[model samples]
Target: MDGISHITFIVRDLDRMAEFLCKGLGAKEAYDSAGNNYSLSREKFFVLGGIWLAAMEGDPPAERSYQHVAFAVSQSDLPAYQANLQALGVEILAPRGRVQGEGESLYFHDFDNHLFELHAGTLEQRLGRYGMGR
Candidate 1:
């Protein structure tokens, strides 16, 4: 099946953004080149979920071009993750609850104004619900 191997985003501060996704979101720093790019993960699989948050060394444009990125998380660990985010003063877009018929999801923005949706359920589940199963 074709699944997302990773998602990358541009940030204003590489270190701060990396830390937030690594520590607050439980994603481990998978790789770094000492430049401006970094990869983080909690597992190793071809269809697995991974992320890359990066920032250019020079000055960025007046306005960023992207909106946000949403990550998937299990419902069981959400409370703990929420607490960690709260401790860091991270703003949440939605409280812990079901989103209409979309199961459970928590929305938030990263340091680069990129929004993220942490959802529950497996890749198959997501595909089935969203018509990606075909």
Candidate 2:
């Protein structure tokens, strides 16, 4: 099968989500439905490091969970991301324990309780560290 076509999030506010994506993660706003919904509801599109991310108007999850979408980031960029998110008044989650070689991560939740991760590790590095290398 082909790779992911796009990732969509059900957010309470399209504008807030757009700000979080653009200012917090450096995503560029590709399109805004602007009350014209060709899909389920009002939605906005963004391009994040070549990945298509969509945010739609809807009720978010009632509670937070570990389930989250992770974006690949450089190890050295974690601090910058953390600062940006903090300035946006986003909640930064404490990272779980990790092995030394697995690389670093920064986790946070958007206004609608959608969790996200900026991970510094590559799949190969994580697999090797976990002793599951191919």
Candidate 3:
């Protein structure tokens, strides 16, 4: 209870969303309820790097937004992830480039219109980039 255990996002199609997360982000399907809600996780254990991507049914249709979230990844993994995403027919931001300071990073958006960023740097290095460290 010290921190957020999981996050849930409402999506229009469970199957499609699941596929997107699995293939595009390397998330594994952990569970799915009969109600069409599913969860994806990086590993079986819940640790500092453990993350869960849950998709639930939504109404009023799904719309794209500028709002986005980011995830950390190895710099070496960025190109492959981008390639995988492109293979899945996902739209990526143009002029894709990397920012280096504490660590290198790449930014892109997902099918659900969520912006996600991948960073390749240590915690301290990343924190310093945003002046989080002094």
Candidate 4:
């Protein structure tokens, strides 16, 4: 495989996550099933910015950590994205300490305790800022 094929999230409320994905992140529903055969559980599929995301009915995580999926976003649009998340009632985490040249981020958690990040810098940019030639 050249890269990530998809990412599946286990969530307490499948429907809530579906709404979060659709309205909060502009993910289009790709499929819906009661878990009859495909995944063997109630699940919702979505396509967000060309990435496939799946949410399956399950227990919310017992805890959360810094491990998260960071999606690329432009610095100019970060504020609007934050506003959208606020309007959607998502939980925003405190900004973590970052290196000067790394980039900026908005960290947040979903209803199921899944952390996500919208990053506003490229890997190359961060490397250069770190004084390492990219």
Best by lDDT: 2
Clashing pairs in 1: 68-114, 68-115, 69-115, 69-116, 70-117
Cα error, residue 88 of model 1, in Å, equals: 1.7
Residue 21 Cα positional deviation in candidate 4, in Å, after optimal superposition: 1.1
**1-134 per-residue lDDT for model 4 (tens digits):** 69888999999888889888888877899898965747657888899879999888877678998778888988898888888888989987889999886889999998888999999989898888888875
lDDT of each: 0.60, 0.93, 0.65, 0.86
Better of 1 and 4 by lDDT: 4
Name the candidate, 3 or 4, with the larger lDDT value: 4
Clashes of 4: 1
Worst 10 residues of 4 by lDDT: 34-43
* lDDT, candidate 1, 1-134, per-residue tens: 77644555555666676667766777666555563334342222112255444333333344533355556777887888888877777887645544244557677776666666777666676667777785
Off by over 4 Å in 1: 35-67, 95-101, 122-134
Model 3 C-alpha lDDT per residue in residues 51-74, reported as the tens digit of each score? 766667564135656565567788
| Least accurate 10 contiguous residues by lDDT in model 3 | 39-48
lDDT of candidate 4?
Answer: 0.86
Q: What is the TM-score of each candidate against the true structure?
A: 0.63, 0.97, 0.72, 0.92
Question: For candidate 1, what is the total of clashing residue pairs?
Answer: 5
Q: Please give the clash total of every predicted structure, in order.
A: 5, 0, 1, 1
